[model samples]
Target chain A: MRIEIPGEEYMVSGHLACPGCGAALSMRFALKALGGKIIVVLPACCWSIIAGPFPYSSLKVPIVHVAFETGGATGAGVKAALEMQGDTETTVVVWAGDGGTFDIGLQSLSGAAERNDDFIYVCYDNEAYMNTGMQRSSATPYLSWTTTTPANQPKENPKKDIMEIMAAHRIPYAATATIAYPEDFIRKLQQANSTRGFKFIHVLSPCPPGWRIDPELSIKISRLAVQSKIFPLYEVEGGEKYTMNFEPKGILVDEYIRLQGRFSHLSEGEIELIQENVDKEWNRLRKKAGG
Target chain B: MKKVLTGNQAVAHGVLLSRAEVISAYPITPQTTIVENLAELCADGILEAKFLRVESEHSALASIIGASMVGARTFTATSSQGLALMHEMLHWAAGSRLPIVMANVNRALGAPWNIWNDQTDSLSQRDTGWIQLYCENNQEVLDTVIQAYMIAEEVYIPVMVVLDAFFLSHTSEPVEIPEGGEVDKFLPKYHARYKCDVNDPHSFNLMVSPEYYQEFRYKIQYAMEEAKKVAKRVDDLFAKSFGRGYGPIEGHLCDDAEVILVTTGTVTSTSRGTIARMRERGVKVGLLKIKMFRPFPREEVKEALRGAQKVAVIDRNISFGCGGIFGHEIKATLCDEEKRPQVFDFVTGLGGRDVTPSLITEIIEYTCQNERPEGEIIWAGMRG
Candidate 1:
């Protein structure tokens, strides 16, 4: 078996992404897979600023910068317009952040999935609203310390199961991939590229700024998430069948949390409680995957 | 061909004739039938286009903006609340300079949730940079939508063709829909100076610094000013082909009159009968119909009301504690004139209340008789 990366690059250097910005790397990998025949519909997110200001862009492909909640809807429109022009080669990729996908953009995303509008919806989850200075999002994990969820009272609710929600739409394809696993990310994108109907890819993007981690640990944090089974990598097809992509080593969740300052405020009791919840979720996922 | 149609159906017919490549809409009262009929047109192959039944008005407008960015003619329709929901994207469409055409059925905004006709919904968005056109009847509704695309594309700005709720949207009237080929001959396929092209790539509507942002705002304002001329030119071309021309502002019997009643939307239709009745009594009064509300038509309005002693503006919408919206604009437009007419703001038929012929007649008499309105806003036909 061989691991290969696509030679072509759509995301060039000189972009404003910080050190170990997983979302930036995720886009770089996405563009490599999607190639030149794509248009990115971006809602307000980190990339809205990261892609540079007016009259300048980091990516080679065209970007349609829309409001925060309009990613899926805008992508559908762009795809339809291209179809009407008798040019269906270009793929409309809705690139959005966690807050956009899990909260404001949910209706639009669900609608697009229901219609099975021909486009790829990529929701890169950096855990919270990183662009707005580390506010909490529905996608923010339980016991995390975003600005909104301060150190005193960390995020109370568990991270939303967007994969399950999207799978319920019974879309053709729904997959999870992270930048730490480029081969996995690229493969999933290529799968989405080949699929005919609506496809969703959830990328577990790591943010150094909002996560209060050393910029060097962004990718390391992502690798530990999979290793600890806190953020599992998997795919769902037709909103029914679930396939686990990687098997975590059953490592302690503390190995992942200790590297990031967001979880530093948690006591021993809270850490154990989080570990128990992760075990329960892992057991349920394993059951579904026939482990 | 003469077909009796509701204002919504007229919009659908116009969209079909104009060959709008994409129609994205969500159903809201009064605006529902337009997209419903459009869906049928799409299904029957009468119109070769994609009809996107969106989840919400936000998505509806967002989708249209996307389609328009791809150099395809796009359209959508909604009313009051739905229009309000799409308010944020309205700026996006205008700022991106995408020439998308939309039909807005004028429904009242709600705290009590009213679905009737009122201009407040569209009037509230006057500063959004959309070229707003108020329709007088079903015929005008059908004609203006086609002209909206022409003007919108020419100036690279979005156009909103607005009509009153049930009075126009639900009321059936005879409309002469032009043939598709003839409309195509007049309004050709959209050719974009800039768009989302794959082979030829460029970023559209991205982040702007304070330094260059003002220049973009200036360009949109300049385009809006140009839209005034483009609207008239496209309307003239529409007339040359179809024999129906709707100027930005049309002054009726204003050649010599003491009082002029200014109206917009379907209320202008209701005002006509009152004007005729007043004329039989030998009262020298006239009607000034504002078809184009944006670019305000300052010159035409100034020229039309120059000699009139009293100019009464019958607004179906108010600016909340400030009097009527049109009243404010007309007053500001006439403030510097050497001999400006005393502009009185009279609000009538709000929240779909009936603006009857008798009411209009009484309003005309009141404006003619009083030197100044006793109050800033005269609420017509209110029992309380």
Candidate 2:
């Protein structure tokens, strides 16, 4: 397969992101797809640090760093203001962490989406709060070992069904993408950019330090997540119409889990429990997709 | 032609005349009527602007921020918890310097969830870098909204035009709704010097390290200081054309009074009424209305209070653990003065509790009779 690199590079090379950071790659691919006519609204997260310091920005596009819990609202505001100026050609994309999107920013995000605010909201899921040091977030998977949730007591809550919550808004577009699928990810971005009203793209980005995974295996782990049916790639149009983009091989969830240290402490029973949950979720998604 | 209009309707008319391209808002009590009127205007084609029906107050502010960054003259109105929800983006709007104007109908914050008049909501955001302008009446509310955009765009700072909750927001008074052309002459199109331009790309509100963070903050402070002059110029230009004027601080009988009451927003009107009644009875009292709260008008405040024997600050908002919101600011401004007036702090009218002219009279009479307490905040109207 011929892999085509993006012709335009909106993201600069000297970003302060960690080596092989999946969230950084997600940003690169997103900016590449959206092009220079983009305004990135970022909330407090790893990306906040990754964007580099002021007067020394890493992206060629304009970035508006908002508060941790205001990504959706800020993006909506930016988009509204832009349209007011008769500049509807530019795309407003909100890039937020799982903590920002799923937890603190959920109310605002839900509000914007429900209003069908003309903008793109991308929740880069790193699972935990990597910016303020890895604390447990709502997006943190059950049985995950975040600093706040030690092995003795892993995350008590299951990973929030963010895509479902977004879908509930009956938004024009909502999709799941991953760093390992650049083509698919870019395609979704282009689709979202063209669509009117609220469009959401949930990117399952891997965090090397927070996830306690080998930096080199970031992409590999992300791929395994889909292959294992742990994080399926799918899209919903107008919220109700669901379309699964990729079919997982239904590999053992342990294969995806073994790559990360955070899940290493899990016992066989716990791993099996997670596998059951993944399978159950995939089945439900398949049913929704009319497969 | 002067017409009696509610403060909310006056603000709506100001936004309409200012030619705001977008108005996004959620319905919060005391502030709901402003956005509701705006929505009606859009529906009636009285204003050619997008009236976004945002689901929450957070989204309302956010939508305006987005609109303003792309070079739109954007506006929104909210109060209380709504303002708190937009607390995070308040920094974003100012840091991005979008010059988005907001009308914050001041209300009490929640735990008990009471929705009434108080300065706590807006005053709590004093550090968010927004240029705050408090209005004393419907006329000021109407005029200040027009001037806020001018001052905000000039200094590249987001401006918050605050009105007393039920006092100004709901109360009806005669306000001159400036003509569109007149407003156009006074307020220029919002042409942002630095904005999110795609063709000529540049990063905005980017992360800053210690080396550049201080400079960024310093520049914001410099812009705020510059806003003081811009505010004065805008007010002057406004008066020249409309034949009325206001300042960062409005002095009422302060020229030769022995005691001056320092207040803000609609309370200033009641204070003036109280001062007038007192003067008839041979009490030498005056009023100092603080219109601008962010740049604080520290030098102007000190100069205004310099002649008074005692200055009693009446605050409607509490800092909780600290005393009154305005009292602290007043003391901070007078801290370095060698011969300062005896500063008496009085906290009253929180959560939209009424502060009639008689209340002001009592506070002043008490201050004159007793030794002015230093560093102590006296609750004037709280009943057990």
lDDT of 1 by residue, B1-384 (tens): 899999989999999988999999999998999989999999999999988989999999999899988988999999999999999999999999999999999999998999998999999999888999999999999999989988998899899999889898899999998988898899888788888998887777788999899999999999988988888888888889999998999999998989999999877878898898899999999899998888789999999999999999999998987999998999999998999888878898889999888988889999988999988898887876
Scored against the native two-chain complex, candidate 1 gets a DockQ of 0.87
Q: Chain A TM-score per candidate?
A: 0.98, 0.98
| Best by the lDDT measure | 1
- Model 1 chain A lDDT-worst window of ten: A1-10
| TM-score of each model, paired residue for residue | 0.99, 0.94
| lDDT per residue as tens, model 1, A68-167 | 9998899899999999989878988999999999999999999999999999999999999998899999999899888988889889999999988898
Q: lDDT tens string, model 2, A1-291?
A: 334758888788889888879999999999989888888888888988888876778888878777777787778777766766677788888999999999988988988888788889999999999878789999999999989999999998799999999888899999999999999999999999999999999999999988898799999999999899989999999978999988776589999898889998999999999988988998899999999
Model 1 misplaced regions, further than 4 Å? none
Model 2, position B299, has a per-residue lDDT of 89
Fraction of native Cα contacts kept in each candidate? 0.82, 0.80
Tens digits of per-residue lDDT, candidate 2, B1-384, equal 789999999999889888899888989898989988999999998898877787787777777776776678889999989999888778878887778899999999888988889899999999999999999999999998989888888899999999988888888998877778888888877787877677876666666667778888899999999999999999999999898899999888998999999999888888877898899999989889999999889989999998888999999999989999898998899989998888899999988899988888889998898776745888888787
Considering the true interface contacts (CA pairs under 8 Å between chains A and B), give the fraction that model 1 also has. Answer: 0.82
The CA lDDT of each predicted structure is 0.91, 0.87
Error of 2 at B295 (Å): 1.6
